[model samples]
Target: MTSSRSDTRSKIVDAAERLLREQGPTAVTTRAVAEGAGVQAPTIYRLFGDKDGLLDAVAEHVMATYVSAKAEIVRAASADDVDPVEDLRAGWRAQIEFGTANPTLFVLLSDPERARRSPAARTGMDVLRSRVHRVALAGRLRVGEERAVELIHAAGTGAVLTLLSTPPSDRDPGLADDLFDAVLRRILTDTAPFAEDGPLASAVALRAVTPALDMLSDAERQLLTEWLDRAISAASPVTR
Candidate 1:
């Protein structure tokens, strides 16, 4: 978009988000947003296609902030030699805080259909996948990398939603921490496992580095990945 169009889009999104924050989703009508943004209603249609499209942009704006923070956390791991598990925890806490603090925006971003199509939502998952890969490389993840990512994602989402559902005064403040610990216990080893402990941990660690195994032929890489996947999933519980 040109500078003018980009500025116009920003103004409209800002107005819509302010309405969403102050008065909930219903308050973000095109007419209201146009008036707040000092633009014609046709401008909103031109820029965003429709209100649903405008809301998608709103979700993207909120999720882009979230996903950028998450990406920085992932980038810091390699740059600073941070512990991957601790990095995961930091990201988890950030996610929880974001969700609980912006309940309306969180609801918009977390809607499954919107998430499926949202670039920012996918970027957030990519950050988590990277985080999980770091843990697997450290041999601290006792499950497959994909499985670990799913577990963490599910647990974190559930924790946020559960917290949001309760009245703040009645909510258990420790619940998020406790749930993270529980998930860690389920998906991690006390220490990096020895070869004899089980195939699961070893498989996960190897899986994390498989793409960088330059010596392997295409067929060999494919075969090795298939074997590791089978071994990892053999005992893994299915996501419901």
Candidate 2:
């Protein structure tokens, strides 16, 4: 019985998502979704409570699938030793494309309260956080990882929402790219750390890769990481 109910729930959500993607949010009425899923309207109400609840389930399902593919892409890029910046750019482009392609779902996630309640949303952030960590490991990040992730996420979300609000014909082709470049400029440096560049970037980078310093005893590695963390915190302009 539980399996049967779960299957029915999946069927309803699948139908709703298809409607959302092919048409728009307005097309996903309960009657339409019920017909699409070949289920009675009460079943949807029983399973999801209402339209808002149904939408939440759809958002979670869609984002979970997207994050799975995104994680694989990140893993493949890492295996290929792609430049960390390029990998991040690829991920950024993927996000923009996904948002624009699924405007309704993206809008659902635009709400901080809803997104915060989503495990898939948090996993998506972890992927972005890992990418930013790589940039720090490459010694090109000028800011701390948490700050950089926040900035990039905010810019990307705003860029997608702006594009979605405009008609496709009226949208600027370069807007997303320009915003990404601006975010990168704020978060990254042109080159890896050098002696003259000061200690912040180097400290950030060293802290990132500190776990791999296997020659040191665990206690020594811990001490070094603590020192690097202090140096990075002191030098990060945002921290002050």
The model with the greatest lDDT is 2
lDDT of each: 0.86, 0.90
Estimated TM-score for each candidate: 0.92, 0.91
lDDT of 2 by residue, 1-240 (tens): 999999999999999999999999899899999999999999999999999999999999999999999999888978989899999999999999999999999999989999999999999999999899988988888777888999999999999999999999999989999999988877776573354434677778888888999999999999998888777667776667
What is the lDDT for 231 in model 2? 75
What residue pairs clash in candidate 1, if any at all? none
Report how far off residue 127 is in candidate 2 (Å): 0.8
What is the per-residue lDDT of model 1 for residues 1-240, given as tens digits with 9 covering 90 to 100?
Answer: 599999999999999988988898889998999999999999999999999999889889988987997788689787999998899999999999999988887878778998899999999999999998888888776677877888889998899999999999999989999999999987886574354435567778898888889999988998999998887777553432
Q: Give the range of the ten consecutive residues with the poorest summed lDDT in model 2.
A: 189-198
